[model samples]
Structures are given as structure tokens and as C-alpha cells.
Target: MSLSIGLVVHASRRGVFEEAVESLSGISLKWVTYGHERDIRPLVRSLVDGHALDGLLVGAVPYRACRDVLPPRLPVAVPRSSALDLALALSQAQVRGWQPVPVSIDTFDHEVVAEVTEALHLDRTRVTCLPYDDDQSVDDICAFHQRSLKEGSGYVITARTAVLRQLRGALRVLNGSPVPSSIRSELHELVSRVRHERAGASGFAAGVFCVGRHGRPGDLERSRTGLLHLLRATPELTDAWIEDRGRRGVLVLGRRTLFERFSRNWLVVPVLDQARESLGVRVAAGFGVGPSARTSVVLAERAAVRAESENRPCGYLMEDSGLVVGPMGPGGPPRTGLHRDQDDRDRDQGDRLRELARTVGLSTATLSRLAAIEQDLAGRTVTPSELADAMAITDPSGRRLLRKLHAHGLASSEGSAQTHRKGRPTGLYRLAIDAALTGSADGHPLTAV
Candidate 1:
């Protein structure tokens, strides 16, 4: 399927981003341009409200400005200027007889500056960098450049257009915002994620709803009628195919996204409360995802049966891939449900994993998610941005998480990656979570030490 990507941009760098787009094909782009920073918030709001977008591409500045308006589920790619971009600007400064060292920089992360300078054999000690963050303002960046000028720095390098504009007349400045090949790579990655999500959205899902029995007469008929009535009245389930299955179960069929949303990402099902109070009976919902209707319905029925054993109205989800998530009551955070096939060894490993999380001062769920992400990485090193994207967290949070991981011996630096020649080398971290849990590369659990 063709992906519709929204491109939120500044008027100044339109050509640069458009230049990057020349290499990419098959994706429909809708541009949202803003002249000044103040215009970004409203412009992004408009883009989100009006457009049915599969993904969005925006720079760091614009992203920071309007992150609140962006949907949490929307796949967003924030393209950054890489160190290669910085290198090109430094080269231009050198052409003008300006040395790269003893320079002030703004908006670029300190790690990026360190990598680029260290690579070029420049003295990083002589360079000053002011990294960009949501708390930083144009005035704050301008003040940093001003201080650098007074501190015997020859020039300033800035990625922000506003910072560049404000300080250009007063300082010897270089524009560090080069559209490196990485931006295109980042877009391609976003497109891939969107396509993956689309494929998942089209997959078949079935929800089996079974009402709890009270040993009354006509229990089956009343249960069936009540389930159908509730399913039909619910707005979210309107698009789903509702069918009567056997005596006790009612099947609701639709796209995977529909159930994910209805179940609040499988954390909670709000309808359990509605049925409990209105129908005077407990309704257990179990959703299953599979390649076909028969498989999904079979799985859903099993899940519903599992939910039926609970004392109150609840729900559970069973995917064909062996993940079981549930007891999805109307409250608290969602916990990862154990797989039906979890053996004794697997259960022991899980216990050790929880202990590790506790030792590291993190919740079990967060650690479990980290373990899942590590598994997805397949032993490859990951940058903070990549880590953040995988975890659905902010970039700064990713950096902090990386630091925590490294500090706790859960992650290790595996040098850097220069995926494309033009940008700065991104530092990659190899996670050692598998080792931390098992105390060795093999499956043997760690002994107390």
C-alpha cells in the first residue's frame, strides 16, 4: 500500500528537504511549511487534524514544538543533521581559513560533536557545544553563541535557522544543517514501519465474548442475546462482523487495529464494566489474532474460556505467535501475560528477569519491554534514536535510558556506525541484558554473588 507521509518543515530549509526527497519514490508527501517557530504549533495541529497520514517527517525543532498535538500512535520520523553535515560545514569554514577547533556550536548534540572532532583529529577540548533540547529557546542558543564569541571563539556553527539568523551578523557563523543522505534513510525506515503496521492492520482478529452463568433457565439464550445487543450497541464494534458461535460464545471479527484500540492496546477493556453494571452478569472477552477466521476464532474461544475462570468481568488476548496478554480488568497498568507454552525453565528465567529489574530500580514491565526490544535487535548495536523509536519514547529519554543501561552493565558501547558517509558517526550500544539475567552468554541462570 502507498503511504501518505506528512512533511512538517520550515520555509528556509524547504529546498534541502525537497532535495533529499528526490531519491525517494512511491510515497505521497503533504508539506506543512511554517515561516517562524511560532507558526509551527498551529501548522502541525492543522496537519494532524486534516490529513489521514500513515507517517510524519519533521525536524527536531518542529517536532519539539508540536509533539503534544501529534498522535501517540502515529509513526513519526524526526530527521536530524548528522556529523557528516557538520563536517561539510567545517570544511567550508576551513576554506575560509577558519580552524574547526576553538569553535562554538549550538543545536547539535555533544556526542555528535565529539565523534566528528575525534575522527578528524581535531582537539575536542577546544570545542564548545550547546546541545538542543525542548527546554532550550532561540534566545538561549543566541546567548550561548554570544558567550562563545567573547570567549575567543572564531565562529559559531548552528543547525537552527532562527539561531543562524539571529547570530549571523554579529559572529562568523557556519550553517550546520546539511541534508545528509541519512534523512532519506530515516524516511525509508519510517515507510517500512508504516507498511508493517498496515500489514498488521489488515490481519484478521476475532473476539470471543462469553457471559458467565448463574444456573438460571434459558441462560444460553439470554447470554447470547445480551452479548449481541451489547456488541451491536457499542460504536467501536460497529464495523466488526458479529456472529453467534455455539451456545455461549459470540464472535466479533475485524481488523487487528480495531481490537487493539478497543482493548486499549490489550491493557484494559472498558466494556467489561458496562456489561457488569447493566446486564447484571460478568462478560469475559478474549481476543485472538491469526491468519484466518477459523484459527482466530478458535484461539479467541480459548482465551474467553481462560477469562471466564476469573471471578469478575475481564478480558485476555492470545495471538497466534504464542503471546498471551490479559486479565485485562478495568484498571491498573497492563501486565504481559505468560505464554501457554512457558516451561519451567522459561518461568525461572522470567523470575530472574524480574529480580534484575528490581535490582536496577526499574519496573518489571519496563525491563520485559527492554528484553523484547533486545530480542528484536537480533544482537545488533543500536543508537539512542533507534532505541527510542523501538520503545515509543522521546529521544532524550532514550539517551537517559542508554546511560542507565550502560551504568547498570545492561548495555555496552560497540564503537560507532557510519551507515552513510556524509553524516556524523552514530554511537551504537550493544545490550548485555541477556548476560545480566543469565550471568553468562549461555542459558544458565546467574547464581547469587
Candidate 2:
């Protein structure tokens, strides 16, 4: 069977929900419609009774609605609604001079309401919840506006299509308007195009991993803009970085070839270098030949390790065959063993392992074991049991570990008859590809090795 996936969402805004699902055309797809019934029980029951679902794409539906419905094993991809949109809308709602006090009536499912409220910190008194209405006229909208004015507040209405359309116009009278989509769409499209370009290439032959210390609070933001400018100018280098709660300042490098095309932009390197220099900070660079994204991440660790060791204005570590830079000397594997390492080396190794785990979707302990096995297997062949013993894991545990790695696309399974004594050949697992952040396609690989 062509792996069947279902797209699920609230039935109120079936239009946008369907539009988003249709966007996935040419990919294996299916749909399970809910929200059409008078109550949500049938929908939940249907989900529980449905056949095995390979994947589930959910929109901004209430967590309460699906809390008991969705199976835990199904992979879910949700549209991360942009915070900028809510910010813009709330800003517009606050401008009292433009119109009477504004108010909001939202019938959005609980999840969406939580998202918007958490994002905007909006007060409940300012909005109403009438998910559906048959005869909402212009006069009603005017009345809401007048009430909001009388109360010295603004109306925040949340409805599916009908309310969104009505409020969109009503709010316009109050000068409450959505931020334009042109620039945002353009930027997203531009990034997407770059991803496609690099994905078509063989891979990133040369990469520069830069680590800067004594940087500003907003150095990451500035660095991103600088990299974008460089990309605009050079258009030969592709880059990826993550800015989340856990990792806001650190940067990661990856091979662009594994990514889609248009990702490689040569400008990312020197531009970031110059930006760092301008900030009066030192940085280390790691350059390698055809390094995989995983290798690049390790290389970045090497650069960081060297930079801290030297305690110089900046440290640079690049891997070009054997041309090593920075304090660590070269881009080789970590030499220190877990059993016999100083606290510093142990901590650094832990960081490296955690980073790898995040990339490959394995636990830190699993990755550490895998690294040990890789070291043992270097320049040699060993039995699965031997590898398992080296990592201090039972054979069954090793097999389970392998399965986890395979599911995350970090390793592949091969049917080796020599290893199997049973009716049919069982599969053995081996390393596949390194997970790196580049462009969108690279961000989400279609196939899991």
C-alpha cells in the first residue's frame, strides 16, 4: 500500500483546511474529515476506529478535542501559526483613535484560542465566543464597535470563516488589519528556492563553521541578517541555524548538497566573519572537504573546543584533509575516552553527544554508545554482539537501539543472510546520513533511512 496519511482539522474552516491538504498533492495522501457532526464524540470515535495511520497533519484544533483521540505513535505535522500575525492583529486592535473601542468574539477551538492568547496576552473580557451565527449583519458589527467604544476597549472576535470574514471587514473600520503577507511570503519563497538549489548539488564540498565569544545579546540576530545579505550578494553558499529557547546564540553548519537546490550561498562565511570582527569578537572556523552535515556539526564542536582551549581573541578550526587550525589541532574524532577524561573533556564530549542526539533523534546515552561503536569499528569489521558488548548493552538492547536510529533516519537496515540463521534473513543496521539544518526540504527529509 502507498503509505496512507490523513489530514485532520476542525470542520468549521474546511476551506482553508482542505486548501492546506491539497497543497500536499503529488505526495501520498488521504483525509479523515471531522467537526461536521453536532458533537465531537463521533469524530473522536472515528479516529480511534480508523485503520492504521502512517502520519497525521493537524491544523490549529483544540488539544482537548484530540487529547484522547490521536494515537501517540502517529507522527504529526502542524502549521506553526506565525506569532507575527497575532501581534499585528492585536496592535491594530489597540489603536483607539482609528475606531471605537474594539472587541473580539472568537469561536476558535480551545487550542487556537490558547495559542493566540498566549501569543498576544489578550484579555477575555474584550472578546466573545459565538462560533456560528446565521444573521450577523453590518448593523451588529457596528453595535459591537459602539459597545467596545463605550467600554473603552476593543472587540476581539474569533470565528471560523464567516466570523473571520466579517471581523476582517468590521475590524478594518477600527483600523484593525492583518499585516501584509507579501514580504513574509517573499522571504519564505526565497529561502525555499535556495533549499531546492543546494539539494540538487552533490553536497557541500567546503563549509565554514564560525564560533564567536564575547558577542552581543543580539549577535545571533545580527549574524543572521549579515548572512542573509551575504547570501544575496554571493548566492553560492547555503547555510542553516536554529534560534529556539534552548539554543538562541549557538550556530550550526551543514552540507548544502543534502539539502534542496538554491541552498548554497558562498557569502555566509566571510560575511559572518566580518560581522564578528566588527563586533570585536573572535571566532573559529571549521572547513572540511565534502563533509556531511553531521560531520560539520562535529567539526563545529571541534572549533568551539579549540576556541575555548586557546582563550585567544578568536579560534579557528577547519578540516581540509589534515590542515588543522585552532587549539584542538585537527578535525579528527574525540581522542579522550569516557573512562579516562578530565572534567572539561568529558563535558565537551557530553555537549557533542547531546548535539548529535538532537540531530539524529537518539538519546544522549545512545549516541555516546554509538560513537564508541564507531570508534571500535573504525578500520575494522566486528560482529553485532561485539559492538554491543563494547557499548555495555545487551544484544536485545542493541537491536532496539538500532531500531530507534533507523526510525529517525540516522541508520539503515540491510537484510544480511550471513547474519541470520532463521527462516528469513533479519536486518542489520548501519549508519545512514547525518541530520543537518539547511533549508526546508533538508529540514524535513521525505524518506527515513
Candidate 3:
């Protein structure tokens, strides 16, 4: 299939990205170019609404700016300013008869800056680093550089081209855009992901909808009928097969892709809100994935029950691979499970799972589910926010889960990472579950993984 990818780029860096024309083989391109960061939102909206795109490639600023408009399930890849980008910029600065020390940098991670400078044996104290964040603006970046200049910095390095353009004449600013090789690498990887997800879209999904509280049997019947009607009339769910589930609920059956488009990739379900407003009833919904109808129904019913317990009307999703995502109501909720759809593992591994689950005070099933997550992560470090996103949970819940895993010795901290230019760096951890799973569960130290 010919995949269409929408690339949201700042105009200044267009040349850099276009240099990778070789990566565009057999793919249709929809370039959304903006001169300033402020122009990103509208351009992204038009591209998303008008184009049939398989995936989106964006930068930190554009991703943060237009996140609300992008489809939740759309494959997105944000190529960060990697260490290689930093090292190249520093090398260029040195070749230009400039010193790396006392250099102010914006948008690159703090750890990245430290690594590059330390490797060059430069004075770390002289380097002023302002990390990248979604909420950071071009003005904010320029201010950091200006502040650094006032403090006697030799020059500034910026990953964002807007920052470079804004301060070019007044200051010695080096462009921090990734080279053609880096952009090409990112482009190829995004294409691979889009292809993989498109293939997985054939998976089956089931949705369960239940009314919250009702006054009488008559009211209950009326509410259930209303729920069924609302779901049927929803244009997004037109492809779904809807049926009466019970006295106060309905069942929806469809392909995983169909449901994802309807639920905004399960981040929010507008039909529930319609039921709340039109039918004057609260509807708690749940979605589940499986290879067969019966299994999907069972999982969907379980997810519905989980959603009903959330104090407010919400939605939850559970996959056969053991990932649970939801509380997808006014806002998303806690997530803690695997991400990809894995083939059912042999039951022979149950013994170790039970033992590890016992050690950590979680269910054997939950432990087994986490094992899938660990495998997906390979040996890479994870942050709470990233973990929460992987499991479809909230940030607060991710932090809490991080603390819990740390306390339980299931994860080991690899020190903290700076999330923004200010505030504390979020902790990074490695899942230590494998360590316990391999040996006697009695002695395995549980650290934040």
C-alpha cells in the first residue's frame, strides 16, 4: 500500500528535511509548512481534516501545538534532538574557530548536553542548557539564549530553526536541525510503524455500554433503548453492529480500526456525552480486543465493569495481550499493561508469574501482563509519563505507579531526566521484573524499571 505521511515542519528547516527525498520512495507526501510556531495549529488542522494520511511526522513544538487536532491513533513520530545532533553542532562550532564551553543551548535535553560537552572535556559549568518541552515557545527559547549571552556565553545552539532565525543577526546561533541522515532514518522508521499498524487494523473489537443509575425498571428500559439508538445514529459508528446487551446496556461489535476512529482512538467517546446530554443518562462504556467474538465480548464486559467503578461515567479497554487502557471519559485514566498484541504465551510460564505476582502483591495475570511490557521495552529506560502513555494511563497515575514500582523494587532508577528547562527532572527506570523472574523471587530487589 502507498502510505501518505503528513510532515509538519517549520519553513526554515524544510531544506534539511527535503534533503531526504530518497526516503520518500513509493510514499505520498503532504507537507504542512509553517513560518512561525503559531501557524502550526491551523495548518495541521487543515491537513488532518482534508488529507487521507496514514501517519504524521512532527517536531516537539508542532506536536504539542496541534496534538488536540490530530487523530489519536494516527501513527506519529517526533524526532528528538538526539546526542548526534548536538555533537555535530559542537563540532561545527569548533571548526568555525569557536569554543564549545560557555555555550548556551536550547531544546536539547540536559543529559544530552552534558554528555556532548563532557566528552569534549569542556567546562560543564560554563554550559547553560534549556531543555525542550511541548509548551516552550520561540520567544521562550530566544529568551534563554539572550539570558545566556548576558551571562558571557560565547554563542548559542538551537534545535529549532525559528530560534535560529529570531536571534541570528544579533547573536552567533548555530542551527541545530538534524542532518539529512537523521531525518531519513526517522522517516523510514515512521513508514515501518505506519505499515505495521495498518496491518493490525484488521483485529476484532467489542464495545459494552451500560447506563449508570436509573430510578425504575421502566426508566431503565427507556434509557437502554435510548443508548442503543444513540450508538446506532452516530455516524462514526455506522460500521459497527449494535444490539441490546441487557436491561440497561448495549453491545457494539466492529473492527479495531472502526472503533478507534469512533472513540478518537479511545481517548474520548462523544456518544457517551451525547447520551448524557440528550438521553439524560450516564453511559459507561468499555472496549476490548480479541481474535474471537466470545473472548472479545467477555473482555469488553469486564472492561465495562471496570469503567462503571470509576465514580463517574467513563470507558475502558482491555486487549487479549493484557493491556488495559481507559477511564476514557472527560479525560483519560490510569493504564498499566502491555501495548502490542502478542500471541498468547504458553501457560507453562505460569509458575514463575504466580511467584513474582505474590512477591509484588499483584495478580499473576497482571504480573504476566507486565512481563509483556518489559519485553516490549527491551532494555531501554522508561519514564512515568512514557510508561503511562504506553499503558494508556494518566500522568499522575504514571507517577504514582512509578513510585509504587520503585517502592516494591520492581524497577530500578537510572537517575532522573530533565523534562523541561525548569523544574525537577523526572526519574528514569529500568524494569527489574526480569531479574526476579529469572531467579528465586525471595532475593530479587524491586526497583523502578
Write the residue-wise lDDT of candidate 3 on 1-449 in tens digits: 68898898877778888887555687988999898768999999999999988878887678778877877456676776767888999998999999777788887655567567767888887888876654567887788788777955599888887778789888888977778787887788778756645554787889999998779898999999988988898887898999998877799998888987776555566676678778899888888888887888899999999889977877888988667865565321222343111101212233455544533334343455455567768989999889888766688867655554553457766887898999757879888776676653433232110
TM-score of model 3 (CA atoms):
0.53
TM per model? 0.56, 0.30, 0.53
Q: Rank candidates, lDDT, best first.
A: 1, 3, 2
The residue pairs in collision within model 1 are: 83-424, 84-422, 84-423, 84-424
Error of 2 at 267 (Å): 33
Model 3 gets an lDDT of 0.74
Candidate 2, residue 438: how far the Cα is off, in Å: 31
Instruction: Give the poorly placed runs of model 2, Cα more than 4 Å off.
Output: 1-5, 36-54, 68-73, 78-100, 105-156, 159-449
TM accuracy, model 2: 0.30
**lDDT against the true structure, each candidate:** 0.74, 0.41, 0.74
lDDT, candidate 3, at 111: 53
User: TM-score winner among the candidates?
Assistant: 1
Cα lDDT tens digits for candidate 2, 1-449: 34455555555545555444443333354555665323444565576576665545443333334535666434444332333444455566555443322344332222233345655655644444322122344456445544554554445544233334555544443222112352233223323333333342445433333434436757755654453344334333334433221222344343544221221111112333344444444444434323475665565556456555654433343342332332222111224564234434434544444444543334333454454345435534444455456556677656545544543444444334466565534445455322221111232211200
lDDT of 1: 0.74
Q: Each model's number of backbone clashes?
A: 4, 40, 12
